[model samples]
Target chain A: MAGYSSPQEFVEHVLEKELSKIEESESDEEILNKLKGLGYID
Target chain B: MSSAAGLLLLALMSAAGLYFDGGSGQHLAYIGPGAGFAFLGSFLTLLWAFAVSAATMLTWPVRMAWKAAKRRRSLKKARVKKLIFVGLDGYDPRTAERLMAEGRLPNLSRLAKEGSYRRLRTTFPSLSPVAWSTFATGVSPARHNIFDFLNRNLKSYLPELSSSRVNKPRRVFKIGRYHIPLSKPSVDLRRKSIPFWKILGQHEVDCTILRIPITFPPEKFNGRLLSAMCTPDLRGTQGSFSFFSTRNESVTYETGSRYPLQRSGNVVKGVLEGPDHPLVPDAGKLGVPFTIYLNGARNSATLEIGGEKYPLRVGEYTPWVPVTFKAGVAVKARGICRFLLNQTEPDVNLYVTPINIDPENPALPISHPSYYSAYLAKLLGAFATVGMAEDTWALNEGAIDEEAFLRQAWMIHEEREKMFFNALDRLREGVAACVFDASDRIQHMFYRYLEGRADGPLADTIEKMYQRMDELVGRVFRYVDEETVLFVLSDHGFGSFRRGINLNTWLLDHGYLALKDGAETAGPYFKGVDWSRTKAYTLGLAGLYLNIAGREAEGIVQPGAEAEAVKAELIEKLSGLKDPATGETAIQRVYATNRLYRGPYLEDAPDLIVGYNDGYRTSWAAAQGIVEREVFTDNPKPWSGDHSVDPVLVPGVLFSNRKIAAEDPGIEDLAPTALELFGLPTPGHMEGKSLFQAAAPA
Candidate 1:
């Protein structure tokens, strides 16, 4: 919550937190497999 | 990354027909109202971010110097360094007093003893939206232009979202079957007066406002804010949950949609409805196909959606799943929803939460600065973005049970706590405020359990929520120092909605409202009503509109003296209405809006606001503009409690860490109080005084 100088730095920190959750829950391979099933990716 | 350049590229690519295929011969795409805006909005947001960053770097020294000068001037006569408002929506004074007497609410009782606790006067209708609007602007509903949750479209005679209005792009480029919108859609915040935070921002005071009602399409100011009530889901509705089941029953729900799924062996397949496909002409709502693999022996399932598989157990909810709806080759709208596995063995039933605009890449502006929501999502992971995040409608419709609903409510509460604490920890000066709605939602659904003696674990649900909120207050108290001023308050209190009074039915029975010939029951929005002959009608939770000349589309009653006479007659007849079933008075009084509100927008207010007696409210049918056969009926829905009664019966509780000399402080008083705390004078248009002041010499 503190020590961030700019809004961009603050935003990047938040993005890191959000992206970490996605990585923790499901890997890229799992997402790709599911996408293949839905015809979103080959 | 300029918006003009982006629009030019879109036009050129669309003209080239790059993504068009010979699927239906027409290359027309239909984007849902919200999805189209999201695509354009996100692009513009990115461009704006880049511009802002560059501008900040260029003017860093000048900005810093200016801020220092402004801060010195702003804090010259300040009383405190920080002011915090903790809003517990629908926290009743009576309930708090009872819990304090029992010594169950230690923190609140201690705060009351040390400072001040009193009953805060609520708005006429005692509604959250109306009262909170008053709290933000220091004005009545007439000045704020928010009388109820819904307002009638005078032209169409249909109920529309009152606080925010979204308008589609009027000008479009028509090329063959494709209609490309050349202009961006506009979303307007309809609340009339300026919020106090904006005034505070003008004086260089930093404020972090979280989940305050009527703040959707967050206004630009020198502070941060996340909107609350009336913020629509990704689908451009308040909140619409999807229930997938294999049952043959076709039922209708007030707020949610049910999709019948066909199960084959152990596999059940269904399509999750997404935003409309923007590139396809005449295309209905877009759908994301999903597959559920049921493990009947284990009572578990694996739901495969958007190329991701989530494990779900019976009575358990899956974490939010990010969904992408593709409209064209490069056009995709992002949203998120959670999945709850309701049943699997006898009949497969899966519940999908309302698709909230992904905070990381929001479709609409749900926070001030536009990037604030994205920053929160990046900071704390994804959270509920819809204003009314709790699925009260799903529980009321019997789609999800009480336990499932409670879990959802608590999860939302946890998210709010994170955001609230984040603000408090970061903000050393200025104002920090956040409102928790679980207190309101839980009591609305669990008050019935308290009325009747039951040994079920869920019977103590309301009491448990109160205790949890008390713990939250204790945490907040620990964070506050002498330099900070804290205020904990609610917009209104709660009362049981045991019986419903259909005002339309009463009007029909009393010959005030007339329907078309041969119509026994009037449909929603008064479809069967012959407005030419109709004198009055009831449409929202508490509104009663008269068909007056020069106002209504089909005016019958004249305005001025004639309208006054009609209002008087209706009020005299409607007041003290009784329910035959229980032989109890259903309506306590009826308020004439003209008399209660004195502002420019008084004409827009409903002619009469029904103040129902405790334990009674406007029926579901009446709220939807239906004239039912019976005037009185039992409210068997899970949403068994409400505060839309007489304002006197549901006075909200207000506890301040600082002593307040004022008695009977209304919600409107808080806005001016916040200004005065910051050493700023209240605006001339504001109609409220500071709560803390010295007594006059006797």
Candidate 2:
């Protein structure tokens, strides 16, 4: 049986796979950590 | 399957088979009954041709993916040591080119010769905030939701100025990982937008940012940054000691004091006291009094007043000395007193400090703390102790003359420059974008030097300013190595506007609009206009739009009516109407924002637009009537130049010591290119393509 019920869900799943293809996908926590290391405090 | 369905299935099956089989397995094949086998073979041949074509079409994405991956891998192999962004706000290319030909800006000229330069296309309304935001976001105004310098606050329906602090809420927030505790609400780090440096920081690249406009209370990040808030009260010298005593305490503390305090040399050598000076006479000299010791001579007579004994040094430049006093001592005696130095005369005032009730838990001193952060904290704490407005520490200068204004601006610029260089030197993987507002500020203030006709007008001063900017470009290029890419950017270009245009009156005159309350003295577009009957409305930033019901509260234009027709009519009417004096058409081209905004962001845009004729801008004030009879005339007052008109051709300059493809690159491409240079992933949200990947110049 197919895991996804709809085309939109299927498209999203495929897109996520495409995104993960990159070695270092961006994360919010990582971005925030990087900014902090730079000395900009919010 | 039906014949059609069967044919489609056959086509899909063969296409998938050929695509999966690579190249060698693309030959025709037939396995069917006797006579039809020959026919099947013919169909197979056609099917094979179709499959091969499909395979070729499908291979492009794979190739693109491969190339992108290869480029990403190659970029990872090398690293960018430094990245510097130089912003020349409102730098006109025509003036720059003329100066370059004259060989005035040798530094900038050298950079142009060594790197790639192209005329950049500025955004609509062509205002500073709009263009600069576009440069920062690498997206169009519609996408970024910053269409005009002033967007109408929808709920209020009031035309907001770009400079108004009220528009701060709609402003995009840039949040980094660093958290700075502020009295005001901490900045929302969750805003959904990414800046170039933030992206670089994501990949562990550190950046130092100096004086970029619109960033105040700078967000937390991995790099050092001095927030560029170009307010009047910048902390130059926070706290300084002032000696109070009897004598001519002529003190020239510093050249640029926010406020001038009086002092004389006699005060230092005279009676000096601290609040803690002992009450008992002869218990201790309450405070030491000495003659002003400068240039090797005692300035004047001294008197013993408070604790601490110090001998006077006369007529010699002496190092700074502190005079201490015991607690609960009052020496009330008339003596010549000086506080501020350098004045022929000085003012005297009582200096006092409150005693702590509890020695162990003494109230936090409001006086200057030894540390800068501690001083700021104490100052903030004092505000709570005695309810004071946030602006209590604000610096105020009374009525600065033109010369004084220029001096102040220059001083600010110098400090900003230090902050810029400091940040640029430390950046590793990220692009360090720094904007020098001095160029724009100076241009706005002294454009009269170029455009002014009366009293010592400098000829071609605008061109000279451009030359200065070119030199700045040259200075920035020195930081980049062969691998580092550079971009010289501007928010918008500048032009001279003679007169302002008013569109409101034209609508009223044409009977397409109506007043709000049928009152005679109702202001135009001010609460009285019946929007239902109004076919089109023109605001300061947005030209005209049909009042469609669901779309707009008072939309008058019926749904599905030819919007182009109304736009065409408006354009024709606006174009035909010429200024009586100059006879120039004020309306340039009524561009549909959709046609121009092709990148990611496009929601917030004006419906029907009107670009003014070059050298003409809208008025400084809105009450100046919507329709004016005159076409061209000298500008009214205060501001001599305006930006609503078509700005001069402005180009972003890109430089590399290495030979680069002489191809045009979009500003958005900069972020991705930086990522590629550092071997980091360019987020999918980024729309810019790398220039390095573009084919080399012929």
Which is the leading candidate under lDDT?
A: 1
Per-residue alpha-carbon lDDT of model 1 for B1-698, expressed as tens digits? 45455456566665555423213323323234333422243456669989999999999999989998998898899999999999999998888888899999999998899989999999987988899999999988877889988777665566667787665655665554444565556677878777889988988999999999999879999999999887777666677789998887778765677888889998899988976555444666778889999876657888899888999898998988988766655456678999998888678888999888788767667898888998898898899988888888788778899999999999989989999999999988899999899999998888888677234879889888888888899999977889899999999998988988888888888888899985768987787999888899988788899988767778899988888898999989889988888889999999999889787667788999999998998988888788889999888877878888989899999998889988768898999999999999877778778999643456
**Model 1 DockQ (Cα-based):** 0.02
- Given the true complex, what DockQ would model 2 score? 0.03
Per-candidate local distance difference test: 0.80, 0.43
Worst 10 residues of 2 chain B by lDDT: B30-39
Model 1 chain B is weakest, by summed lDDT over 10 consecutive residues, at B21-30
lDDT of 2 by residue, B228-311 (tens): 321111001111123342344344322121222234443333444322111122233234343433332323222233333333
Provide the TM-score for each candidate, comma-separated.
0.88, 0.57
* Model 1: residues with Cα > 4 Å off, grouped in runs: A1-42, B1-55, B453-455, B694-698
RMSD values for the candidates in order, in angstroms, are 10.4, 24.4
- Taking all chains together, the TM-score of candidate 2 against the true structure is 0.57
Give the docking tier of candidate 2: incorrect
True-vs-predicted CA distance for residue B197, candidate 2, Å: 1.5
